[model samples]
Every structure is written in C-alpha cells, then in structure tokens.
Target: MSDERTAVRERAEAVLRRLAGDGARLRDDQWRAIEALVVDKRRVLCVQRTGWGKSAVYFVATALLRAGEPGGGTRSATEESAATGPAGAGPTVIVSPLLALMRNQVEAAARAGIRARTINSANLDEWDAITAEIHDGAVDVLLISPERLNNPEFRDTILPRLAATTGLLVVDEAHCVSDWGHDFRPDYRRLRTFLANLPAGTPVLATTATANARVTADVAEQLSTDASGRLGEDALVLRGPLDRESLRLAVLDLPNPTHRLGWLADHLDGLPGSGIIYTLTVAAAIETAEFLTARGYAVASYTGQAEDADRRAAEQDLLDNKIKALVATSALGMGFDKPDLGFVVHLGAPPSPIAYYQQVGRAGRAVEHADVLLLPGAEDEAIWRYFASLAFPPEDQVRRVLDALDPDRPMSTQALEPIVDLRRARLELMLKVLDVDGAVRRVRGGWVATGQPWVYDEARLRRVAEARTAEQRAMREYAATSTCRMRFLRECLDDPEATDCGRCDRCAGPWFEADVPAQALDAAGAFLGRPGVPVPVKKLWPTGLEAVGVPLKGRIPPAEQTLPGRAVGRLSDLGWGDRLRALLGPDAPDAEVPAELVGAVVEVLKDWAHGAEPWPRRPVGVVAVASRRRPRLVRSLAERIAAVGRLPLLGAVVPVGEEAAGGAWGNSAQRVRGLHGTLEIPSELAATVAELDGPVLLVDDLVDSGWTMAMAGRLLRQSGAPDVLPLALAVAG
Candidate 1:
C-alpha cells in the first residue's frame, strides 16, 4: 500500500485503540467504511450485522477528518473559524432516535478521546451551552435526536449553522428515515432538509443494523446527496451477511398469555447474564415486570411513559447486572450497548422481521452463545393491526385539517383535535406528515396552513399499507416455519446471502422445554385472573374547547361528575383483557354480559366494598346508560350488579340528543359536547332517585373517553340521587 494509505490505516488503529483498547483492531470492512468517509470523503451506507463495529467506523472517521493524524488532538479554541461556526472545528453531528441510545453514544465517543456532547429533549437546559460550545469549537462531536431536526426554534435558529459547519453528518439507526422501515417516524424525513442545507463536500455516513434491502435502498436514496447539492443513486452500499452465529434462536408457541407468563417465570432463572424481556405493549411490559418481581426475579420496567430518570436507572441496572432484565417495549430498542447480555425473550412477536431483528440483536453482542426465544402469542397480530391503523390518515382527514387551519392564524394540536375528531397522537402524526408535505407549517404557537397544492400520495401510501400487511403475514410464518429461524428472518429482511446456522430450534430441534411447572402455571393464572383497573374520572376539559363554541374549560364541577370509577380490566391488560377485547372491539355485537365476566365484576364490587375507602353507603339503586352500540350489554351488567348486590334496579338514562352520542373518534371536549345535553333522567326514574337515600351505580359496557359516564351520572345526580358511582366491565385506554 502507498504511504498515504498506510498512514490512514495507522490513524484508524490509534483511534480504535483509544475508543476500545490497545488490543482492539478493525476488521477489513470496518477499515473500508472509515476509508470511504475520512479519506475518500464519500457518503457511505453500512448495513452490517449488529456487532460489526458500525459505531467504530464513524468515531474513527471523525478522529481522522478533524485531527488529521492518529490520536491527534484538537486545535486551540482561539483558532476556531468564526465565519463557518463549529463545522470549522470539524465536529461530527449524529442524529439519533432514542435518548437511551444518545446517552450510550456520548459515553462511547468519550472513551475514544472524542469530545462529544448531546442536545436532546432530555437535556434542554444544556442545549444553549452545548450550542455555544460548538460555536467555539470546544466540542468535537454533537449528538441530536431526529425529532429535533424539525423543531421550529431549532430548525429556524440553530440548524442552519450546524448544517453549514458539520464536518461529518451521521444518521444512526438510519432505517427510521425510510417509510418502509418498521418503526417509521415522519420527523426523520426532515433529515432531507438538514442534508440538503449542509455545506458542499461534508462527508456523510448512515448506519443501521436493522435495515432490510428495501429499507436500505430507501435510506440510501435519502443519503445519496453530499454537501455540494449533488443527488443521485445510493452513495455506496456495503451490506453484509446479517446472520449472527452467537444467537441460538427459537420460537415457543405458548397456548395463551397465561402460559407464556408461566413459562417465563419458570425458565427465567436458567437464562445467563442480564438481558431484556421484550413485550408488545407498555402495559404488558409493566405487568410482566411486576409478576417477575413478585415471583422473586430481579427486573424493572422500561417504557416511553417512564420518566427519563427511571429509564436511565433501569438501563444502568441492566448494564451493572444489578437486575436480571428490563421488561420493555420498543422504547428500549436502539443504541443500547450491552456486550455480555445473555438472553433475549419476547413475550410476543414484533410486527415485522426487520423490527424483530433489530431488537433481538441487542443480545449476544459479546457472548460466545446467547439464547434468543420468541414466545409468539395470538394477540401479536391484534397489536400489529392496532399500530398499522395509525399510518397517515385518509385524504378527507387531511383535508379537514387543512380546512380547519386559517392561513392567518396558527392552531395548536389540541384546538384542532376536538374540531377534527382525531385523537391527540394521530392528530400530531397527521400534522407532522402535513408539515413535511408543505401543506402546513409548525410555528411557535401552533400549526398554520401554507395553502400549498398538496396531493395525497395515494399510490405510495397504499403500497406502504400493503407492505405492512405482507410483513404481518411474514411474521406469522416466522412463528410457524419449521425451517431455520435465522434463515427465515434473513429472508424476511431481503438479505441475499441468507443461510441456516443450524443453531436454532427449527434446525437443531427444540432447545427449550414447552412445559410450565404446576405451581408456576397456577400463579400465572391467578396473576392474570386478578382484575381491577380504575378508570379515573375526567377532570380538566381539553384545551381550546371554546373554539368549537363549548363554554366549558378547566375543571369539571363535582356535582356534574361521576365518582372515580372501577373497571374489571383494561383492553390492554394481559389478564382478562383478551376476552374483554373480543367482547368490546369494533365488530362485537350488543349482547348480555358473559357469565364469567359477571363473576369478575362481582368480585371487583366486593373488593370495593371491603376496601379502606369503601362507599359511604351500599348502592340503593342501579341506573344503566342508554347505548347505541351495546345496550343489551350495559343493561345486563347493571342487572347483574344490582342482583348480586341486592340493590334496587332503577330505569336507565335515556338519550334525548338529535343523534346517538359517543364514538371512536373525537377529543374529550367534543365528546363531552356530543353527550352534554343528550342524556336525561326520566320523570319516573327521577321520582325513584329522589326517594333513594344512597348513591346509584351508573353502568356501561365500556368506558372509552369517560364522557358518556360523566354525562349519565350528572343526569342521575340532577334527578336527586345523592351520588353516582360509575361501573364498567372494560376500560379502553
């Protein structure tokens, strides 16, 4: 090799030694990636396996491009170029997805003598200081969350400088940039703008362990451009075989959720070093962790809903081997660096093989062998379908958002929510899509329509939807396939060099027993069978309700409210939740309460009666809400509760509205208005309530937004009942 090339290789070795250790060295592929970025100044896309040292390539490249020598340090702060800002200092800007991942990246970068700093939602207090430090060239690397790229303040004020000066731009977990990716985020597409605005010749590198061939191509197309504004084919694709030899994969088809929980409880002790217990939902993660902890396993729950401090604690506990595992959702997916993690167990299959690969990739990174088991459940598809439904809304829904937005005034998401009838999350997602398409702009106050001619990319969206459907089918096949599980995953990801390792259950036969101990099974059953989830009463009115001409705002009056309610189960609960979902989901017909659920409700009421703060008096009467969807179910439940408790059954609350109230759509305030004046107490029921000396139980089959219960209870109270206690069989969260 030429001296120039030899020197570059020597520099890469020195940098790797600083980041890793004196013994650390780069593989041929790793060196090639660094050469492309640091020497050739070319944009590169690396689609290697999880433990292929992807991060090392970027860190090594950053050291080479900025320092210009092996282990060379930074120049004095006074020498920093004021005209070009921090890019003059040649700092690497990494766009990361998860806060946990960013934290890991910062620490990893620090080990290599790389001066790394991060600006994310979790560290707002540090952003100004970090940004100033970047301006002064004190920071060598700056890490940012993808969502920050689109922030009005950041994009308007800070991004232009960072983009212009960024010496090397890195898109970590690059799969998210592609809509074809399993965990697509609309904000990630905003990276195109960041990429477009960079100064000419800024080297770029995108890295991901989870991209399928399609995702790789999609992300590549986005990264094809350099700082000079030239855009064409993928910069350079270096995809390698995706199979991990250290992972001994398997799938166990448990009979039910109870059995799955039981098997986990019985077998968890046998797993090696601390790892992750992946769950399909946050509630499931918490439930699983709670059960495991109760069963004497050392574990903690980590979900997006957790506070940053708690997530950090849980991550640290796992890293320190202080806990056996962290039961988590996809929130814990990317950028976690645990090399000796011993096992990875999934309570349910992810929606796609690509997503599954990304998550299971967390284990066996530094181990000779690690167990990767997928406990597939019947509910996996349901969860998949639920997430699929959140994709970009139909054209009509998009147009409604456009029409609601006046060019002159910006509308906050909360104000648009009650008007457009979309939930908060879906509304925000729609707004993000609109913002990207140039139909609207997000400003300091809210979103404003740009009046741009925006066409719904129907064909593209349909294709995406169809792709999700196909992926779900593939996931099911993965569970049922008798072929090598690793080969099935690789094939699903469209990896050309797929091969069977003969280390999986399908290839080598079952490595784990499918049996659960009797005691464990009983405990799992009892744990899941135990039920009672409180449905808190609605308190504050949704913001901007008056824009829709509803006068109500702030807190609801006590006299017009339902008491803090109780439900036998949440639709998302692992225990009785599955049964409740079947009974209350969109297609279920109005019917009497099931006998089994009737017993569960009785138990819930009995527990309430014997609790520390039991009802002031036994219910004197029962009142059912007139239902458009499940009248029979509501009436039957009320009758059962009244019969079992030996209370009088009063007439149901009648709906006097122009149309039936309550729906799957709409925000809290809109829901409140729809049923605000609709529910009425009949004169006969009024007289009966007036005579009652105790509170009445207002019954419903399901409590979704809680508006109907509040409205119905208000009518009972107005009709002279002393108090109203709301009860329901299921609460849809």
Candidate 2:
C-alpha cells in the first residue's frame, strides 16, 4: 500500500479504537471509504441514506487526515488554523441546520472521546467560552446552526477560528441547500455565502440521505465544488429496504379537515417506539396533538412556533420513546435522524411525491416493521393547493417585495416594512411564500430577498403543474418499479448504485401494475402531432370553409363564404370558429383559413383532409437562452416559455464549462464567487419550463456582449447536455 493509504488505515483504526476502546474493529468497506475521503482533496458529498452510519465517514476522515503528516498528503489548513489561532487551537466549527441535531452530534463525539460544544439561542456565554477553549486547543468540534452563525458576533469570532483551523466542515441534511428540495430554508442559503468567505483549502463534506438529481446539482453548486466524483469510485449507494416487509401502506381520504385529527387520534392511541403525525399547518399540528392527548396518547406538538426548550423537550421525548406520537407541521423534521420511528402518518396530502417519499423515509429507519400512511380527501387537495400556492406568489406581489429590498444594500425586514403593503402578519406570510419560491433568504434576525424579481402570471399554473407532475411521476415510478427498490432509488437519487437489495415494497410485490404512463397521457390530452380519422361533412358546416382545396367558392356549403373586403364569414355561425379566430388575434389576416379549426373542428375538418392529425393545443418546442449560469437563468426562461406560449418547459441546456483549480469554470460569477452558484430562474417563466418535457432553447440577450453565453454553452454540453438551441432577443454577430 502507498504511504498515504497506510496512513489513512491507521487513522481509521485509531478512530474505531477511540470509540469502541480495546479490540475495536472497522469494517473493510468502512475503512476503505473513510481512507479515500481523508486522502482525496475533492470535498465529499456522501449519499448514504439515514442510519447507514454516515457520521462515521466524517469522523473517520477527520481522524485519518489529522493523523497523516500535516502538509504532505493533505492541503495545508488556511491561515485560520492554530498557526492563525492564538497558538494552541484545534477547533472545527460545524455550521448545522438545527440545535437538536447539533446536540446529537456533540453527544456522539463525546462517546468517541472527542470534546464538542454547541452554541444556539439558549446559550450565548457558552459560545464565547467554547471559542476560548477552541483557541486554547482544548476543543475538538464546535456545533452551531446557520441562524446562530448569522450573528455578526458569531461570524466574527467563529469564521476567523474556522479560517485558522485545519479540521473538517460538515453539513448534515444537506438537501436543505437545494432549490429543488421541498424543505428549503432561507437560513440554509447563507451557508454558501459563509463558506465562500472562508479561508482556502478548507475541505467540506456534505451528507444527505434524500437527494434527487436536481438537489444533488444544487448541493454541489452551493459547496462550490465539481460533483464529478465526490460520492466515490466503486461507491455503491446503500439503501436499506423499501418494503417494510412487515409494515403496510394504507391511504385514507377524508371528506373534511375535521375528520382527519379524529381519525388519527383513534388510530394512534396504542402505537409505540414513537410516531410522527405530519400536518400541513401549525393549527392542524396543534389540534392533532391536543386531540391525541385528550384520547390518552402521550402526544406532543412541534413546529417553528414552539419555544426552544419546549421543542427540545418534545424531540427528546420522541428520542427516548417516551412520546407515543408527535404531531407536527411539515417544518418539524429535516435533520431528524431518528431510527426507530414506528409510524409516519400524513394527516394531509403532501404537495408532491418527493415530500411524501421524504416524510415516509422517516419511518422504518430501525430496520424494523413500520408503516407510512397517507390521508387525502377532496378537501385535502384544496388544503395542499393552498399551501403549495404559497410557494409561488403572484408576480405583482413578488415584485413589491423585491423592489423594496436592494441587493447592493444590507437587507432586513425593517427596510422592507415601509414599502410592503400587507399587514404585519400578512407580510410575514408573504415572505414565507417567497421563501418557498426560492426568491428570498431568511437571516438570523431578518429577511434577504436573494433572487431577482419577475412578474407572476397564469404561467405559474404550468410551473406548479409541471413540478407536481415530475414529483408524482418520480414517486409513482419508485413505488411501482419492477427493479429492486434500492437500485431504483439509487437511479432516482441520481447517485451511484449498489447491489439491488431485492427487498423494497415494489420488489416483494407481483410487479407494481401501476398505470402511470396511461394516466400521464390522459392528463396531457391528445398527442401533439397526430390527427384523428376524417369525419362526415354534416358535422363540418357550422364553422364554414371545408378542406383547403375543396373549391369553396363554387360548391360552397352554407358554412363557407369568401367576403368582398377580404374578410371571411362562417355560414353556420358556430361560436367555436369565432373563438378560434379571436385566439389567433388581429395580427394574422383572416383568410378562408381552415387551419385554426383543426382540433375542435376535427370532426368536420377530418372528413376533407387526409393524413396526419393537427398539432395539439400547444406544440412542444425548444428555446435555449445563453447564460454563464445555467441553474439561475435556465429555470426562469423555461417558466417564460411555459407561460406566454403554452409550451411545456422540458429541462435546461447546461453547457459544461472548463475544469479549473478545484472548481468548474465559466458558468457565472455567481457559480464561481457564490458558494452554490445557483442560477436564479425568473418566477414568471417557471410555469412554462415545467409544462414541457422536450429540448430547452438556449436563451440570452447577446452572445458577444461577453464570453458568458459561449462558456454556458460549453458547460451545458458537458453536463449530459440537453439540446442547445440558441435563442436571443439580440445577438452581436
């Protein structure tokens, strides 16, 4: 073995020994993976799901790197290390999403003989003391949430400590950083900005059990690293089981909101090992908790509204298995790593399949039998639509908030209060709406609207529908796939694949037998380019002109007539033809044009015209916009296409740029300078992109204005590139 390999194995064995003590052992796979992560300079994007001992990767990697001769195999720590600290420091600051998860990690480190401390809302002086300890070389890991990290005091002290420290940086529940992730948080957005300002050579390792293709891209972008090989060579994705072989999947559709809590209360009375009942609202969460408690179930409610202590107690109760069930809003769980959850019941319809899968993922983590139940009714659809609608605000409303907050200026809610017309509470809700829209960032004490504002319109309906469709298709595909659920999940996750576990809910069944394709077709209506068989003329007349070459002037039916002033009139006065003419608008001269009546008047037109169906209501076409940043602009243009014209917005044309020093190059300054270089899509065009599933037209204002367009084109080609049809309003050829 190379000296580096020997060094890594030695470090892994040492960490194992420290944790288990005498005679401790490391699995060959665990030892090998940990060794690769430690020696490799590329930051790690670990894709293992929950309960797969993911934290071990970090602990083992840290030990390996620390054990090796400091400068030879590893990059030297930034000036921020002890060399930069007050002489004897070895602290590694962990910017996390939650206080509870931080505590859990701290406890785990303690079990391994590592000294770790946390600083959140509950403790301020402790944070200062921990830094002193870190500066004094007594601290090992310092855990903190993004909210706390946002404090100028925290960043001032901690970032400098981090800059000088040589240890590792870890982000758990990494999906929160992805725009595509359902549980996106504005606080998470600040993580990138913070990381960007960190010292050079600081390696980051992000972990998430649930991440889709889009989420993975966003995560890698945020970490400011190329995603090429972070997961590992021969890295087999390890997913436990989809089938809870012993558990069952049940769905309930209630007629009204009142029926849901009552139903949950009666069913969850005797469940054990802790259960989580998720609702769409805080009110529902509280009501459900109250109802369950009234029925003698040791239930507690958890939401963003709960006091820190109360929330912590509730979480601890669930962890200790003291609480039979915890009722909470969808916001309650993200970094939750509980492994023995017995039941995960959705008291309402989750907005998308990704959400449903993620929530259900909380269950069956202990490798034991567990159930994921869904309760959906007619009312549930409206309720979910209401919640989902909040994710996309009306364009005017969005513009109001955007105009109020300036990017060049330091932004906060106070600066926005005067210009914002909504009531104080309503304003908060609108901000939350923008939060889900990925248009703003929520900071420690205020809000920052990070995205460029665009007008919202009917096009949003398409974006929402497209997003919903994609998520539903993904979920249904996973649930009903014929292959191993683990393998399918790996594919769905867009990560490396391991051996098929052959034990998911779908694998154990006699094939899923789902009619997803058929359902999708029905939803989309008739095919875009095909015409039906011809019909009888008796059905054609009401609208007027028959076939194109049927000699309309001579043997003209009562429905046909060529006017003297170059205007055409329908003989039978069918209102449908008039509507068609109106839709075409005043721009095109009205001829005895039978082209517009293709679909609706198909019964009449089909009789005369032979071969080929008329193009459907909306033809799918490609529209590409040239951009240095694909993620930021592509989505916006796609939304636009889907909106103005009813075209479906397929995906994006990400032109792969050149590989450079520790990062991918040429996409955008945002991609290069910002931690996650997220491409911000205009909200107005989001719907257009969602509706189409074909080629993306490359869009931009000018090609020669700069190299951004060409560079974006190159990068798009590299990233499994979609077809790049360049479309610009103006180009300086």
* Best model per TM-score: 1
For every model shown, what is its TM-score relative to the native structure? 0.95, 0.56
lDDT for model 2, on a 0 to 1 scale?
Answer: 0.52
lDDT per residue as tens, model 1, 1-733: 6667777787678778878889999998888888887767778898888988999998888877776433234444332212123223378999999988888888998887778999889889998899999888888889999889888999999999999888899988888888889888889888888988877667889989888878988888778854454765458788888999899999998899999999999999999888999998988999999999999999999999999999999999999999999999999988898999999999999988888999999999999999999998888877887787778888887888899998889889888876776778888988988888789988988999998999989999999999989988898888899899999999887889999879999889997999999999999999999878787877677888777677778887887677787889988788987999999998988888899999999888887788865766678888888777778888888888889988888889988857644365556756876776677888999989988888898888888888888878877777788888888888875
In candidate 1, position 493 carries an lDDT of: 78
Error of 2 at 707 (Å): 53
lDDT of each: 0.85, 0.52
Error of 2 at 615 (Å): 66
Model 2 — TM-score against the truth? Answer: 0.56
For 121-206, candidate 2 gives per-residue lDDT tens digits of: 77875766777776677666777786664565665657655655646677777777765776665556656555655555556677
Best by lDDT: 1
